[model samples]
Target: MQNKIESLYKETLKIRLFEENLIKLFSDGKITGTTHTCIGQESNAVGIASLLKKDDCILSNHRCHGHFLAHTNQYVGLLKEILGEEDGVCSGIGGSQHLFYQKIFYSNGILGGNMPMATGLSFANKMKKNNKLVCLFIGDGSFGEGNIYESLNFISVFKLPILIVVEDNGIAQTTETKNTIANKIEKITASFKIETSILNYPDAYDIYTKSKKIINKARKGYAQIIVIKSARIGPHSKGDDTRSIKQLNLIKKKDPLIKIKKKIKSKEKIKKINLDVINEINKIFNFKSQSYSNRKVSLQNKKNLILIDNPLKTFDGKRFGELINHFFHIIAKKNKKILFFGEDIVDPYGGAFKITKNLKNLYKNQVFSTPISESTIVGMSSGLAIEGYRPIVEIMFGDFLSLAFDQILNNLSKFYYMYNQSITLPLIIRTPMGGGRGYGPTHSQSLEKFFYGMHGINIYSLNPFFPLEKIYEEAFQNINPNLIIENKIQYNFILDDLNNSKYKSLNTKNDIKNFITNMSLSNYEDDCRTIICHGGASSAVINFAYDDFIETENSSRIIILSKLNTLNIEEIKKNISDKGPIIITEESYKSFGLGSEIITTLIEDEKFKGRNYMRISSKEGVIPSSKSKEEDFLLSAKTINKKVYNND
Candidate 1:
């Protein structure tokens, strides 16, 4: 008991002294970005850290210095991170607010943002049947966030092994929590049927003792919450103190460090521990000064970075929607690790478009119907993927994908690079795109172009030649986050071979073709125009202009692209004839769209420098609900025919 108490005191003191030094450093202009100090609330983090096993995962909020210290105990590395040195934890890309270390510990600046990630980690734990728990630490300020509630509801329904620790310090930067929070934490969590506990004291030992039982329950498939009533002695960050002097004084009186010091009784031991902590901190400064010059070269080396390249597979014929369902059924049967999550994706409803019809009934344990929480759906799936499960999440529409953009951008796309590529996130985000459905501006949008250049993420579109089942198989095997863009208009189209004497197919059944790049030539004697299209636009162009290419004396070529990002520009350049005018068509907007990228690539190449290029895309406006207007809004073969024959 004495040893445990002494260790708790040491941990709390280390966090306190680390922050105190950081406060001085920030004042001295040594640290760059704003730092959220957890000076008075050290017990909350320390208490949670006590019950955590080495393999247990933890996600933290903006005020995360203490949590990082508690889990890692690498003061020097953390100090370097806050100082933004190249030798820092995340290679200086993630500053004090964002820190990822040891693969299991992650901290972000966004409030309540990591909740879904924690829930995902727990979901992974549940799927693997691993007796491990995921702990999430958030401030009272995060209670108002809708994602937190969504995460809580998910955790409750799934019965995931997760522990949520809310450190209620009564204040959020400058505003009181009571003013912002609608209902009490206990009552709100209880409504979800989650087991909740509130710790009103500010003592480390007290916290440690109370948290063990809750954590144990959590590890055994019980999602629980522990609200620690803490006080903030320091301001939220440097130069941001709004609390009165009296309030600060009262907070200092109940400081966890002070309360723990009273129990120690050995002044000599306390003095020695404080001296050791100071020396440890001093070592950080010495190391920082010595390694400052070499840090940049070390960062540039880029160790542990992973690259994904998967080959495309060919399928003969099938309807787009039915093919997708068949692909899902095959992958679900083959890989037990593949889990499907989406809205209305059960047996009867079979997703918004019936792409996942009967998947839930077949794979009862693996397939699940998620609530209308797009952010949580993506975030939690990311967590599940991180823990070695292949999670395929479906967004009802491409437009709603914006709601989950933060998780897709920050967590899913960046986790591999941010963590030095030590982790593989095998997550597939499948959503239907395009504007021919007459569902109006919000529902019918060809938004795949918006996510084109995201680092560490792969994007694919369904094409007529490539097998959808094989695409899913290759996606699962590659171990990267993939975005499969399904066009709404192509859902009912019959995918079959385009056999013509003039046009030669670039892809063969057994040949090694680029994942999504397919090309065919139209033998015309005079014209040398090359048409590049993808997804819905490809179907439109083929339907409208197939006969024009065969009959005309002017020969042209069509290139079908399914993979938008990491395109094979060299391969694409090889197919085009010398000095041919290129026309790139897309269902998305013209500005900053896929067509723009293709044009830029063509212009940059020395071979295609003098070639005439044009882009055929939808006008930069919303797609109306009327069927006729929607048809006019999207790029079609008639537009291509006019561009080619009439030169309109």
Candidate 2:
């Protein structure tokens, strides 16, 4: 018993000394980004962390230095990481907040964002039946975020094996916790029907003993929350403290190190332990290390998805939704890592646009209906992907994607690179976007333009004219996040309607995968025009080209690009081989959209420098619902003609 107290104090003091060194480094401007250190609250990190097995996952928030050191003890790596050194853990990409260490430890700076992700990690462990639990450290300030509650609801409902450690330090950064939260943190957690415990003492042994019991309970399929009422002795980051002098004095008295030190009688042993910890920390500073960057992550316990070379012959007048279902089945058969998540994406209801219809029936263990919490649903994808499950989530409508924007931007886009290429996110968000259906203003908008230049992910626009199976097949191999935008009105259209119907055009294979060109049957005359568009505007552009050719004997080359953000300049130029007037059309508004990007790039190309290019877009005011102005909102044959001929 005496040895345990001394040992715990030694570990806790190691963290304290390490954090003190980091503060010195930050003061010297050696650290690149902001940092949050757990000074007085080290006991919570050490106590709960001591109970965790090596395989048990640990995720932390901004104030994570103690939690990270307590679990991994990679002091030098943590210091180098904060210094932005290439040889550091996460290759210096994630810095102090966003971190991943061999899949055992993960952290992010976002206050409430990590909640759902850690829930996903627990879910993955449950699926694998690995008997492993995940511990997530969150501050009291996290209660202010809605997604935290969403994550709590998820873990509790699923009976996931997760231990949420709340380091309730009385104050949230500068503001007192009482001023922000209406109800007590325990009451809110209890509302979710989760088992909750609270402790106000800083005894490391006491915390470790209690945490072990609760963690065992969690592993047996019970979600738990341990609230450690601790104190913050240091500034939130670097010199940001606004606490009163009395408050600071009081916090010092509650310091776990100080409390536990009083229990030790041998002053020499305590002094030796503290000196040894500092020496170990100092030696790690000189340790040589190599850099680890983004590399191809192997599929977890599953063979890589192989692409069959057989030509797709099934697009013989099949419904768009059925074709989507067929494609999803093919993906499911090829990749075991693929899991489907969305609201009402079960057997009978399928999905909002019937894209996932009968998917659950086909892949019973892979399909799940998520709560209407978009952020948490997306956050789950982030965690599952990092843990080696490629989750395909449906966003019901593209408009609601805004609700999960933080997750998409911060979690999905940042995880791969931030973790120094240690992980791959085969996370795909498939959603229907467009204004053709009268679903109202909120549901009928194309928001893909908003995510155009996000570095780590690719966006694909599904066209009825293109093969659906081929797109998913390519996306599966990419091993990154893919946002597929499907046009709602085209869901009922016959597959390959471009060649089978009255639209008689030539299909030219392009360099980019699934990106094709439809050339008018008329000869490529000198006066031909080039039309750049996607699925939503493909039919309208083709019909307009047919009539324009008939009237003026001028043929049109229509380039339909599925890869929205990643434009192949050379392939695009090949399709626009003839020096003709260029026209870009989009179902979305014109300003700062895909059409603008296309036109802007086309004009910059040396081959089309002197060319006349115009962009046709839907009416701005009619977006979302605008039922009375549906014609104006949709990019139709009339809308295209008015924009093309009116100016000419």
Candidate 3:
């Protein structure tokens, strides 16, 4: 242990020197983009990193050089990544501000934001029974984020196996932490009911010593917090000239390296340590730098058939039991990469909806049953995606996703852009949405629009039908966060009979019973003029239009925008180009919703020539619970048709 400490001291000095050199390079304009350097606080990183196990995960803040190098030997790869080299972790997309190493699973940059993610990872470990600990390293400044408190509160309540390391450097950049943060570190953490340990991070030996014990306790299912008090000698980043040259020079005189080396007496020992460090640095630099410069991302084949099968195809319930059996079999066969988590979301019980019934039986380790924690359900999905798994997590009901919104919006949504596209959050959040069976407003409402408008997210929000095969295929192959909203109303909807025993209900027949017949057919007549519709409401509108409304040749056409974001602009242009009348309809409210966005898009589109378009949408208020009220104000076939034919 002494030898290890001594060697780590040498490594700490190496990190200091490396950072100093990188600062010089940044000043000389060799390194592009801003960087947060970890020069003054070396021991905290080296000490804590040494205590971490191989499979354990670490989440770092913007000042991450020390933390990153401490955890993994991917030094050259990291530097190249910071340098924006093509061979870097994210192939030059994530510059120094966004560096990731899958082996160590470390993330650099993005403020104190990784805490919730780390908390979630611990939740996953517990559910998987993997006995892995997670370490979250954040600066004193990060304690100000609301998510940190939320994360701490959750870890305490759940007793999640995680280690929280707060690097209490005297300053958070130019502003001292005391000004911004209200409570003492220990006091703040203790208020959340978390076990806390404060340490003076004066040297690498001290950090390694305390971190080992804390990490051990966490690995054994105990949660802990290690407050490391240190000082920053370097500027917030390489570019900050906040400290004059004279002041910087004076601070450099008290560098951590000088402090550590002062304790070593023998010149021979110093020389040996110096020589070993130089050799190691050179080896790491040469190998990693070159490899990262030539690295390429291994992406799934563009034409892979793994995504071609649809799980919803089984919803066509001819023989409900057989259809359910075939649904599980198809998901198991097609998306071999899909991972699931929920209570009894496995064989025999598949799920409350039998969606994952046979998945665990076939996939074994892939599909899993998790503890009853919605936060972990979302959090683990984020971590699993970070580790390169195409995880499709089910949150029992749409209402439960609210429990994991921190992991969803803060950690998952912001990862890509904050890291400059360094990480591809290839994940799918599947949940049943909509109200018809009295699940109340919470379980029934479509919440996809909330995520649809979030920044740093290009998620696909889909509620598919009939062409389930095509939708499923596209969803899996597309490398982005996909939110598939399964209409609970269709769970028992019947399909034609197929002769196959496993999939007798899998007959491929498109029925108008619950479908929108295209009104765009040439020579079709319009008695009711124009009808605007979407999803289930549209299905009802189509039948009403054909039955009651008169059909005139060369009349109005229909616009089918399945994905709300990619609202078929071409179709909108075509509809409004002839100055033809239109009716814009949607289930959401008129306030900044799908209908609003569509209206704005149309007004901005040059093809729209002052056309008279009536917007038939829910009133700008809270959604009414009663079916009578919903039918009266909110969008429905009856309301939509009545409004469209009011003056016709």
lDDT of 3 by residue, 213-285 (tens): 6778888778999998776787788755476778667766655566666667677888888888887766655
lDDT per residue for candidate 2 within 268-356, as digits (tens), equals: 98998888988877766555543333232444544356474323554343677677777777667766778999999997888877878
- Model 3's TM-score against the true structure: 0.72
RMSD score of candidate 1 (Å): 4.0
lDDT scores in order: 0.78, 0.80, 0.64
| lDDT comparing candidate 1 with the true structure | 0.78
The C-alpha RMSD in Å for every predicted model, in order, reads: 4.0, 2.7, 6.8
CA error at residue 331 for candidate 1, angstroms = 2.0
Model 1, runs deviating above 4 Å: 266-269, 283-317, 477-480, 496-513, 521-527, 550-553, 645-648
TM-score computed on alpha carbons, candidate 2: 0.94
Better of 1 and 2 by TM-score: 2
State the lDDT at 631 in candidate 3.
50
Candidate 3: residue 580 Cα off by (Å): 6.2
Candidate 2 wrong stretches, greater than 4 Å: 285-303, 308-317, 496-501, 507-514, 523-527, 550-552, 622-628
